[model samples]
Structures are given as C-alpha cells and as structure tokens.
Target chain A: MSAPFAKLPRWADYGLIPLINLFVAFIVAGLVVMLVGENPFRAAMILVEGAFGRGQNIAYTLYYATNFIFTGLAVAVAFHAGLFNIGGEGQAYIAGLGVAFVALSLDTVLPWYLTFPIAIVAAAGFGALWALIPAYLQAKRDSHVVITTIMFNYIAGSLMVYMLVDVIKPLGSMAPQTRPFEAGAQLPKLNWIIELFGAKIRSAPLNLSFILALIMAYLVWLLIWRTKLGYEIRTLGFSSKAARYAGISESRIIIITMLISGALAGMMALNPTMGDQHNVSLDFVSQAGFVGIAVALMGRSHPAGIIPAAILFGALYQGGAELAFEMPNISRDMIVIIQGLVILFAGALEHMFRPTIQTLFASLSPRSVGLAAAKKEGA
Target chain B: MDFLNALVLILDSTIRLSVPLLLACLAGLYSERAGVFDIGLEGKMLAGAFAGAAGAAVTGSAWLGLLCGILVSVGMALVHGFASITHRGNQIVSGVAINFIAAGSTIILGQAWFQQGGRTPALGAAQRFEAIELPGAAALRDVPLIGQIYSELISGHSLLTYFAFLMVPFTWWVLYRTRFGLRLRAVGENPAAVDTAGVSVAWLRYRAVICTGILTGIAGCYLSMVQNAGFVKDMTAGKGFIALAALIFAKWKPVNAMFACLLFGFLDAASIRLQGTPIMGVRVPVQLMQALPYILTVILLAGFIGKAIPPRAGGVPYVKER
Candidate 1:
C-alpha cells in the first residue's frame, strides 16, 4: 500500500520532527512569557542559570528528573499497549502510603538497604493494586481506561486526605504528615556523584533513587524490545484484530502492561518519600504524574528519548521555582503553561508540519524521490 | 418541623450546586453525541469562570461577562476541532491539551491582568447575577407546605439557574425533534455514512463542539457571577468531571442527565451536611462523602449499575477511504 502521507527517512522522522516540535513549543511558551510583560530572553537566561548554574541547582534538577523518568517510563509502557494510563498521578499518590508504611514500621528496626528493598515492593504492590481495578474494567467491562483512570485519580486524592488526616497523623501533631523517617529509612544522597566532577556544592536531595530510575529505564528498554510479552504488547498496540488473529490475548496484555505502568508510577514516590523529604507529606507527587504525560509524549515513548526529555522538564521545574522568586510577574505557573504547550504541539498537533517537511525533503532529493517512485512501480 | 426545615435547606443547596453540573453535562452530551468526546469540559469551565469574573469586574455588567465567557470557551472548542478534526489527531490527547492550556493560561492571564494573585476582583451586586424572587414569593412564604416549597425551593434563584432547568427539555427537543440533531447523531454513530450522504461530517461535528462550548461557558459564568462574587484559582474544581459522569449515568439522554446531575448534587449537599454529624451513632468521615460521586461513577462505569455505551465512533478521527 502506498503511504497516505509521504514517509521521510528514519532520521528525519525521529530526530528532525521532534526537534522542530520542541522548538515550536518553546517559541509559543516564550510568547506567553512576553504576554505577561516579562522579557522572554531574560526569563530564559534566568531559567538556565537557575537550573544549571550551581552544583546544588544541578543536583536539584537531577532529583526532579529522577521522578519524571520513572513516571515517563510508566506512561511509555501503557502507551505501548494502546492504553492511556492517565491514572499515574493517582497510582503514584497512593503508593506513598506503602512507602511510608514500610518506613514507619521497618526504619527503626532494619537497615537502610533492607528498608529500601521492602519499600520498593510495597510501593510497586500498592500502585499495581490501584491500577488493577481500572485495568480490569477496561479489559473486561468495556469501561474506557481514560475516564476510569481520571476518576481513580480523584478517588485517590480523597483517600489520601482521609488516610493522612484520620489514620496516620500523630495524635499530638497538627500537620497531616508523619514524623520524619529514621536514618535507616532514608536513602543516601548522591552528592558524592556531583563531587566527583570537582564541583564544590551545597547538599541537594539527589539520591540513590536516581540510580534506580536509570536501571528501570534500561530494564524497560529490554522489556519492550526483547521480551515475548513486549512483542505481544507492541502487536496489540498496532492493531487488536491482528493481535487476536495471531492468538494473543488482548485482555491479558492490557492487564500486564497496566500493572507494569502502575508499578513504575508507584516507584516514583520513592524519589521524594525516601530520597528527599524522608516523610510522606500532603501532595508530594505535586503534578509529577501530569509531567510524565508531557515527558512521554516528547520522548516519543522510548527510554533513550525519555531520559533527556525528563531532564529538560526537570530543568523547567527547578528553574521555574527560581524564576518565580526572581520575577513577580511571571509565576511558577509559567512552567505549567510551557508543559501544556509542549503536550499540545508534541502529542496532539504532532503531524501539523509533517506534510510540508516531507515535501521539502522530497524536493531537495529528487534522485531519491525518483528511486522511491521506481521502486513503488516495480513493486 | 425542624427536620422538614433542614430537608428544604439541603434540597435548596442541591439545586444551587446542580446548575453548573447540569449545564456541563448537556455540553458533554452534545460533543459526545456528535462523536467528539470532550474531557476538557473542566478546563473550559475554569477558563470561563476566570473570563466571566474578569469581564464583569471590568464592565460592571454580568450579561457581558456571560458573553465573554461564551466567546472564550468557543475559541477553545475551535482549537479542539482544529486538532481533532482538521489534523485528525487523537481526540483524547487534544482534549487533554485543551484542559492543561486552559488551566494554566487562565491563572497566568488572571494574575497578569488583575494583579490579584490569580483571581479577579470581587464583583458587586450590580456586576453579578442576583437571586430573583418570584412574583408572589413574599406573600406565599407565610403559607404552609406548598408555599414553602414554591417560595424557598422554586423561587429565589439566579436567572441562570432557571435557564439551566429550562435547557433540559429544550435539549431533548433539539436532540430528538430537529433535523440538525438527527444529522449530528448520525454523524457520531457513523461519520462515513454521513459523508456518503453528502453532509459534511467535519462541519456537523464542529457545530456540536461549538454548542458544547456555549453550554460549558454558561456554566462557568454561573460559578463566578451567580454562585460566587469572583473567580478563584481552580474554582471549577472537579465539577467538569462530575458532569461527564452525570452524562454517562444518564446514558447520554438530555433529560436523564438533568436528573443524574441532581442526584449527584444532592449527594454533595448531603455530604456537606453530614460532615461532623453522627449517622446511626457512627461519625462518617468527610473524605468518604467527598469521594462518593467519583466512587459511584467508577462502579456505574463498570456496568454494575448498567452499561454506559458511548457513541460508536467516539474518540476516533474520521478518515475518508481513498
């Protein structure tokens, strides 16, 4: 079959298109900054300086990037199985309970390493359990995952509030958060990693969880590309009818993919609950789940691509806080604006400029176009 | 008499809360019935609340504020159309984008324009929609049960609330009795068939989307100008999602949507009253009550209540076979 839209080279399809989309998103974001009566160029400088200027700032950027990577990978896994798992926010939020429970119970008795492994299992277990209901509904009951997931997010929020306020708040303490974890429960800071570069810096929350995120990214790559289950997921994503014809169980793949996605999302809580805050606070997730959607879309649902994309957003978060402090007119909500624009251009309006770019490339390579036409005729 | 008095109060609050939900549910009904599922209703309502409050504050005219809200929502709807229809992009993704864009831009613009920290200035009585007492409310209020119901329950609502209630039957007529409605439903169920019959599927869907924008815009206006004095950041909360749930619970019927919204709204009103109040000697937690609507929606969607079958072509961008 002839291509409905002209297909470009692999390099152009992956590299050039995403680069252009990112450029357009930022350019529009710059315009929004200008609308707020701030100089977009100055804002950019501040954002860059705030995110990367100091060792501490860089550490903070990495810390934030660590969360994005986990959540982004979660979204990527679901995307592979043709599911929109927007419930990552809810899944990760609920996982805080598991992480805190393990820390609160085991931190005093067990060592850090022991607590860490148990926390991982508990977090992943809770997140997967949270996702199981929605996944089951989608697979067996014909309930749309998108709507169910959104509803689940709301339910999770309410549940967390109740748990914090009524169940876990220490009797005398007014705050809706637990007391800080014991030293054994806390993850070790990765400040030494930055020190290796010969940069003297203040302590940042960058922790061992960052390493864990990288490991998960690598594992995700293997799972999606190397495993039989991954092959089924990809096939189901491409077409349900074809997958069914090939004797793959659509319901099973969807359930497994969603569980994996939820587990990755749940693990995101570790970055903050154990790595940075050392306590489960109200709203620790704080829109990171939504950020994952943007990261996954911009990353094109691949681990290699997701790492850099997550860091770019991490820079936005770190720098946006600093920018909000420096410029009263431009608040931290500017980062949210940029995120929305990125999702709009990268995910929704992805192919807006593809036709024009394809035509331009065809015109530039007339000989290749003739060879493509000759090949099509021969076929 | 005291119990009766409390019941009236709860039902009254229920009516007040349900207006926005009712309007938004109808908005989603129009969009989804036309094969375009809009989860962005929340965002549009939020943007409308900001615009409505800002316009009223600037012009001192609530009517103009409503107009401003409608215009802004329609603009957002057109953006959805451009992405999902013209570009043939994923409808859900486009809706998600719209939601985020509205959520962010409203706050940024509100802060920039008003300098009140992501809110519009408080509106005065002249700048807002005030409750209208019916012709005989005062005289009839002194009478018995019928009088109390008429004066307290039926009357004493902002004009927009009445408009919302009237919209129920009007929506039913528009959906079932009009030729445009027939074409809209047909397009949603099978766009290819509509295209084969020489009706422009794109145009039909665009019109339906515009209708959604108008209804949601009015709902937003009600929140800021009628229900409250000004626009607060994220004021719409999760009402848009609640409306979507109501639409599903109603099985996409206009009349049923009104009742579903009322049912949910009553739950909300009852929850507020139930908070800190013991039921059967057990104090029900406020969080559970707050989460009741969403939990119920999940159960209903699971088909434990009944099936919620969406439009056949919902969320799929129509592509003409070459």
Candidate 2:
C-alpha cells in the first residue's frame, strides 16, 4: 500500500457523510414503520414536527437536550480519559435518588436559595461515589470498567426501587417514587424570556439547568484542552505506560476522571428534578445515560462537537415521542432504530466515509483518481 | 426429607438458571481466549431468543426454533466478527451497536409478527423443553443421602442443561489437550507471534466468535423454550453481561467459568428464596433480592476477590501485514 492517498472529493466531502448516515437511519426507521402498517413519510413528518414544528415542541426539545448535555459531557470526559464508562446509567440513577432525597427532605426547612444548590451538589456527590467503585477496581485490580459499570446499572436500579418502596416510601404514597418537592425546591422557570417572544408562547419546563449544562460542557472543554490536569488526563488516555513513564500517576488520573465524569452524570438529574417535574422519578433517567454514548460519539468526543450532537439527539428524542403520540401505529421503538443507526454510522463507519466517498467520486469522475487532486493543486 | 427436598429444589433451579449463562459464558470463553471481546453476547442471545420464539411459534417445532435461533445469532456474530476483524473497528462500539440493533429490531419484529406488543405467543407444553428424569432415578429417590445426591446432581433437567454442564469439561479438554486449543491460546496471548508461526489469527478468532454465537443461541433458545415457555421482549435482560462478568471473574477457564455460573445461579436462587424469608424481623424487599447477583459481581470485582486477569489481546483486532 503506497501511502494510500485517495481522498474524499471537495464538494460533497464534509456534508455528504452526515447526509448519507441520516438517509440510512431514516431508511431503516422507515422499514420498521412500514412493517407496522404506517406510512413512512407521514411518520417522518410527524417526527420533524414533534421536534421543531412549534415553540412548545422546541422548548421540550431543549428540555430533553439539557439532560443529554450533562450525560453526553460525562461520557465525553471518560472517553477522553480512554475509559469506557458504561456506568453512567447507574451513576445517574443513584444521583437521581440523591436529588429526590435532598429535595424532599430539605424542602420544608430550607429556603429555595440554599436547597436547590445543595440538592444538585448532593446528586453530583452521589453520582461521583457511584462511579468511584468501578474506578477503584479499574485502577487497582485491572478490572474492565465496561463490565463493572454495566453490572452496576442493574444494581443501582434495583437499589433505587428497593429504597423507594421500603425505606423511603414518601410518607403515604405507594408509587415507586418520592413525594413531590415543595415549590421552592424546584428550579425557577424562564417564562419571562419565553414571554419576551410574545403572542401566546408558553415555554416548556426548560429552566436554568440548560445554562448549567453549558457551563459543565465549557468546564469539561477547559479541563480536557486547557488545564494541566486535562493534559495529564489526555496523556494517560493515549497511553498509560507512556504517561507513567512521563511521571504522571495513571491510577490517580483514572480515579479523578471517573469522579468528574460521574459528577457530570449526577448533575443530569437537575433537568428533570428541578424543572416542572419537581421530583425525581423512574422515567426521569430514561436511557439518557445510554443515549449519552451516542451523543459523545456523534460529537466526536469534543465539547464543542457535543452541543450540536446533543441538540440533534434532543430533536430525535422529542420528535420520536411526538411520532408515537400522533400516530398510534408507530411505537417509541423507532427512536431506538434511529439512535442505533446514528451510533453505527457515527462510530463504526466514521472513518470509512472519507475513503468510501473518495472511491465513489473517483469512480464517478472519468479522469484518473489522482488527476482531480493534481488539478486542484495546479489551480 | 426436608433437607433432601431443599437440596433438590436448589439443584433443579441451579441447572435451569445456569444453562443459559453457562452456554453464553463458555461461548465468551472461546472468543476471549482467542483475543476477541464479546460484549455482544447479550444482543446475540436476544436475537436468538426472538428468532427461536418466532420460529417456534410459526412452525410449531421447538427443535427447528432452536436451530433458527442459532442461525440468527450466528448471523449477528458474523457481523461482529466482520466489523472487528475485517474493518478493525472498535470491539466495544461494534458490540454496543449489535446490542442496540438486536434490541430495536427484535421488538419491532415482535410487534409486527406476534401482534402481542413485543411478546411472543406462549407455547404449548410439547413446544417447551420438558424435564428429563434419568432412568432408574425413580427408585433412587427412596434412598436417603444417595437418593438426594443422585436427584440433585444427576437428574431432573432439560437435555440442554446436561449439554451445558458437559461443555465445561469438553471446553477444558479442547483448550488444554487439543492442537486447535493450543493455537487459540497462542493467538489470544500474542497474535503477532501466532502469525509469525504461520497460523491465521483472524480465522481462529472468527471461528471462536462463531462458536460463541452458536452457544449463546442455544442459551437464548433455552430461555425462550424452557425457562420462560416463550419469549418476552428483552427478557434475557442483562444475563449475557452477567455471564461475561462470570467469565472474567473465573479468569476465562472453562471449569472456573462453570463454577462462577453456579455461584451466580446460587445467588440468583438464594435471592428468590430470601425474598420469602424474613431478615432481621422484616421481610427483605424483593428488589434487593433481585439485585443480589449484580451487587455480588461488583463487590467481587472490587478487590473482594483476588486479581482476575483477562486474556491478553482480548479486545484488540488482528491486522495482518501483506
């Protein structure tokens, strides 16, 4: 293989890959919808409308994006550290429990000013603690973090169910969730901002959580690209033996990275708990942890990349929900197909796009493959 | 008599629960031993489960369904092998993708086929794997300890259960005693060295993965046809992952993997038993009992057990220089 210099054509190179992947995802989804006797075009239209057709839908998309941002950032942090942290689900579950407990327990005694921040902190702390176990194992025992974290998700979910049903039954409620937090414990809405747009526009329950998500994303960017600690993390992630040789403690970095990642996952609960929901519930965590993996992959594991990726996912999620509601035939399973496709394209076929596109363009052009490139250089 | 009864119950449940895991883990053992990580076992098994259920429901033949399950899972394994082996893609990502695809496609197909909303039609007794009591075992039940031991150790299981148990020794024999086993171990430890020695590393790993797919398919079929009588969407749950953990905790040895499967199975059975029994003057919530196996896996991995080393090059793809 002499250098392997075939490259993607300039005109269709950047935009074509995403478009091809989007087409693939929609086609797969269309097949499934069609199998269920639903019109594919109508279902696709419904999905688009659900995500961005109206102001309310856009707000809902943003509301969902808030959780996606935190979870996506959490995954990106660990991915940067070269660790696959599948335990985001478990950490988020534990953090949700922490949020619920703090919100409910402190609602009566503490004022909103102090309670909200404390609750968010408690959730993050709990999330960090949850991640600590797997980090310790990976650091000390050389156990794979992926297996341990996946197992912990089940453990965390079961533990939460047990706690909610038995020990923390919320006074008299029988549901597998805590009682609603007092009004003060909830995150205040941005209704005033929505009103500024005027004309009967009611913003969804999106709140300050979106700002916190953005801040966390920025903080992750700083930590990964700007700070010394971030340098140590990236070095260790690239090659642990090299990092160790370079005088960085791989164990310490692993533990710290996991802690930060878990804390971000824990913060994800803020969107659901502090928004109009006002309480943490089982459905609140709803695969946000898993979807974070897709977000991180779509974003190419960069903080700047993750914002658009999260919004894209948020749109898909919001749209899928709308499709389900509007068309009784299409189930929420279509979203799973779309997610799976996005992840497949963004992850497995990621590197192949440039080569594949180059090959296609080369075949389409009558001239020799190197001729176009030579012409461009000559120009 | 009561002790004998409890032993029998435990043994029966152990065999039933351990079959799926044993097959899956043993499959995992072969793949990992050949230097390929198989996190897609869960997805492969789910695919198998759905295929088995659908095949059985349509054809009304459990045997054909089992074959169908294996075929579907093998198809998935081929995809996994191609992606990781040929394309040199990330094993973890490929496995996760297979899982998501399996999960989504199964439910989508299940809804379309069964019209029961992601669950299959329940099979008749003949369509399920019936328990097989050994010949002359009926007389052995009259004896005291021997009867209990005979029944608990030797009798009362589906044919697949015995097959799963026998696979442990068979796997060990293959790994330690056979030429192919030596080559597989060699490849897993150092594919470059194996390649230097003229063995095709990619071919060996691909075979190991296919073997895993077949075994996991049997495991998934067992779940649908015997354990639950039919398939429920996502019913295999995380059992495949639990089996993977067991494979790791056992250090990837076939016999140790069997013991690990039993250990987990016992915890599973014990949890179910404990849920009925009172703990410290109060009944333990069923959810805690349900969580026992996963909690134990985490605890065992977290330095409670001694070091558990994975096979060298377990997740790395083999790229041959032309």
Candidate 3:
C-alpha cells in the first residue's frame, strides 16, 4: 500500500532493483535445484557454461534470444499505450499460418528471395489482422483486451489444428506439420554471412531473424522515443482523459499500437519455422510469447533494456535444455519455474524492495532527497 | 429411435462436461465478485488435479485425494492473495505468476515423485470416484422416453457432479440472501463503502479467493477422479480461462453462469460428435469445434450475444489514501 510513497534513486530505480530481483529469482531457483539434491553452485556454473561457453552454444542462445526479442518488444509497445496485450501468443500462432501459406503455395513458383519478402509480409500482416479484432472491440465495444486476446489464443490453436489435420497435411503424412519449405524459401543462416569476415563460426540455427529483430528493436526505439505518434501513445498510456483533452484519439492510438505489437509478435514465428524447422508445426511459437512478458517486465519496456533481458531468458532456455540432458533429476520444467520467479519478482513483486532501497539512497544523499520526493507515487 | 439415442448421448456428455465448468465458473464468480480478477483458475485447477491424482495414488482413497486437491488449490489462492491483496501488487501480473508457478511446480514435482512423465498412475476403482445410482432408477427403467432420460441423464453421474450443480443455488442464496454476500458484493463495487461500514475489505477478498480455490478444487478433482483416469501434465488445459469467459458471458451471476457453462459443454460435446462427420460431403472441422466456446465468448464480450458489465472496481487494488 505504501508503494506510491517509495521514491527510489535513478540508478537504484533503473539498474539496481532489476538486478537485485534477478539475483533473488536465481537464488530461489537455486534453492529449488538444491531441494532436488543437486549442488546449486554447480548447476549455476553448468548453466552459464552451457549457454555461453562454446561458439555453437552462443549461436543457439542468440537464436532463441531473437524470438524473445520479438515477443518482448510486442509487449512493450502495447504496455506503453496502457494496454496489456496478452494475445501475443495467439497472434504469433495465427501468424504461423501466414508463413506456412506463403511458403507452401508460392515457394515453388517464386525464387527464395521473392518468397522471403512475401512470407515476412504475410506473417506480420496476418498477426496484425488477428490483433485488429480485439483492438476494435476494446476501442469501440468496451471489451477487455486481456480476455479477448486469451480467447483468441484458443481460437488460433483450433485453427492450426484444423489446417494441419484436414486441410494441409500434404496427403499421407500422419504428422501434424507441413512439408518442409522449398530450398529457395529457407532463410539463410548467419554463418554464411558471418563467414565473410574470415571467422569460422559454425553453422547454427542463428539466422537472418536475429538481424531482423535488431532492426525491429531500433525501429521501436525510434517510434517510441522519436515520433509524434509515439508521444501521443505514451500520453494515452499515462492518462487517457488527458490525451483526449489534448485532441488525441484514444481509439486510433489503441488500434495502431496493437497492430504494431501484433506484427512484432507474428515475426517471432519466423525464428522457429523459417530459421530452424523449415516448416510449420503445432506450438512452434512454444512459450516464447509468454516469456516476452517477463522480458519486457525485466527490461522496463525499453528496447535498449530488452536486448540484454531477452538474452538472459535465452540463456536460461538453452541452459535448461543442456541441464535436462546432462542431469537426469533436474528437468526442463525447472526453466519455467525460473521464468516464473523472474516474472514474479520483476513484474508483480516489483516494488517490494523499493521502499527499503529508497530509504537507503535518501539517507546517503541529502540533495537528492528533495528531488526524489517529487517522484513519490500514490499513497 | 436411433436419432433419439444419439441425442441422449450428446446430452449426457454435455452434462458431464458442464460439471467442471460450472464449478469453475462459480469459483470465479466468488473471487471476481469480491474484486479479485483471477486469471489463475487454470493454475489452481491444474494444481488440484495433480494433488488429487497423486493423493489417490499414494493413499488409495478417493476421498483423501479430494481433500488434498482442495488444500493445494487453497495454497495457491493464498499465494495470490498475499501478492495482490497484501503486497498491493499488479493483480494480472500476480495471477500470471501463480499460473507459471502452478504449471512449472506441478510438472517438476510430479516428475520427481512419480517418474511417469509428470503423471500419476491410473487410479483403481476404490481410488477413483464411481457413478452413484439414484433411487427409483430401476422402477423408471420400464418407462419410455422418461426412462432413458432418468437413467442416462439423472441417475449415473458421480456425486461431485450433483454437488457442482447444487452449489449453483447455494451460491445464489449466499450471494443474494446472506449478510456476508452483501458485504462481498459491496467490496467489489466499492471497497471504500465496505471499509466505511466497518468491514475489512482485504479479509473479505481473501475469504472469497479461498472459496474460489475450494470450488475450483472440486472441478479439478472431478476431472482427475471422475471424468478421466488420472492427472496428466496441463490436464486442466484452458478450462479455467473458458470458465472465466463463461462468468463474463453470464454477467457474473451464479445461476446464469450455470446455463452458460452448460451451453459451452453442449458445444464441446457437439463438436466431438460432429468431428469428421461429413454433412452432405464436407467433414466438420474439429478445430472449429474446439474453438466454438472461445468464438462464442468473443461474441458475447463484443456485446453481440448480450450485455456484459463487469464489477466497477474489478482489477484495481483498493487503496485507502492518507
């Protein structure tokens, strides 16, 4: 209840709080690992070594990080506009249909270069279209965005199930995935491009999607921090009534923000389907869409902050896979618990340690005391 | 005669499916009515299913399994209350954490204990809920249409199913007739009013949340012990979300929630029946069938099916300013 009264210092607010939260989550996760009879320190060492020790490991880490980046940015965009678009998971799933449709139908007739653009456009367009319905409902019909989006996730799953089983099974295959994309449609791996610099980085799933994600992060920064629309969107998030009084259309901003967010989420499908799997399958989005919420929360919904936050999650994932294989007792679901802890600490329990930190900082610096008081929140 | 039998079968399955949804819907009604928007119903139900299945496997008693289910669900609800109510945390964020914790911990602990792919062993007759035969079923068996209806629809359901339906009227009475119900409703609409009236809003909300956990526990237990053989990973699936949607569609009314859940259950049963059943040459899509409830929920939320007005103070942590 006193959360609004906590006036944390700038460094403590932006840097220390998240770092401390991250440390606590890891510590708690370590305790869980210990509960399972494993040495906590050894497990942490294995996790770090497995994620970043080898060149190939780093590539895979980045590959997974790319997916998180897309989803994280999607969440950040919506959050800035004061909307929680939990529908990122559904949007990504729906977007996979677009990627599959393009790769299946047009890849044979067109070159890979041509098919590449077509698939990307299809993915983003489909994702945005899926988000548009909920956005319109929230803007016009007063339906809650969270409920609508969650429902759409189920709807999207059903759509994919229908498509895979009845409509596009490629004749006799009992498997639920489509046939692999044509060689022309396959996205190029990063090794090919990076090899030009005379460094021998091994071939990995890390591909063009990573670069595309970076470009997206930059674009998001420019849109949020630079553009007039970005300014309006933030204002809307801060106070919708104030935004309305300032002549901004609440509905228009909601729609636009959601569309852009959905587009980013859709792009996540490309990491698995195009970069690695080379085909569409059930649950290819995995839980990346959900992990994005953790990433965005940890990153404070900023592009610069999201990149590292995404890599941390990416590391947890890749390391988790390695641990599952190496240690029989500890399973991959432990990673989920770790992700949950991070989300719990960084998002829900975010202000738990703030008051204590603020008191410490205020006591240390008298000049900042007056300035910090100006930033105090609700009672 | 054949058509009538098929119709009877569908109706039977509908009732079976609706029992869990009905329980979950009522659970959500209790929580949301007290101003705590619970998206963690899935998590709580999943935890309950795991506990029920695991308990039955351990003790070989279905009754003990049911008790274990309730305890685990209540623990989860308490965690949610500690975060959202006590810490004044973001309610949605806290709910999401509970979901993640429930999902992750269930599997991790399940795999640790059973080593059967996060699933307990299939329960035996004594360890699983059995269908109870109602009185006069044998006498009614001789009757024609009424005979089949009585035997199939009314007589053979597990005890939990009856309890779930019975809870509807019980919930209605509690929310409408009792003093506690009035205070609970007042807290949701305006916590300040309740606080001014010398009632503790936090205590009321915590109790409401705990009741939700208990109801959701019954739903979860029914799934593991009655509907199916045992608990599997993510067995609750998205049933919790569907229940929430039903609560919304019913406009947060306990009795209306029962009808809404039954309609959804009917849709589910119809889809299963219609799956791959060619209607004049084209097979009906199972995916569309699976998606039916969600689509209906969206329509309802969009105000096409009906008007849905949420509690005014839902989702906002009640803050008493200095």
Best of the candidates, TM-score: 1
lDDT by residue (tens digit), candidate 3, B1-322 = 8988999999999999998899999999999999999998988998898899889989999999999999999998888888788778887877887788888888877877888888889999998989999998878977989999999889999999999999999999999999999999999999999999989999999999999999988889999999998998988889998898899989999999999999989988998888668878987777777888899989988999768999988998888766
Instruction: Tell me the spans in candidate 1 whose CA falls farther than 4 Å from its real position.
Output: A1-5, A366-371, A375-379
Whichever of 2 and 3 has more lDDT, that candidate is: 3
Q: Model 1 scores what on Cα lDDT? A: 0.92
User: A246-304 in candidate 1: lDDT tens per residue?
Assistant: 99999999999999999999999999999998999899999999899999999999999
What is candidate 1's TM-score against the reference? 0.98
lDDT of 2 at A348: 62
Error of 1 at A113 (Å): 0.9
Every candidate's DockQ is: 0.79, 0.55, 0.75
Stretch of 10 with least lDDT, candidate 3 chain B:
B283-292
Kindly report the docking quality category of candidate 1. Answer: medium
Residues A265-355, model 2: lDDT tens digits: 9999888877768876666688899889888887777888788889988988889888878776556776776777677666665655566
* lDDT for A174 (candidate 2): 67
- Higher-TM-score candidate of 1 and 2: 1
> Each candidate's TM vs. the true structure?
0.98, 0.92, 0.95
The candidate that achieves the highest lDDT relative to the unseen native structure: 1
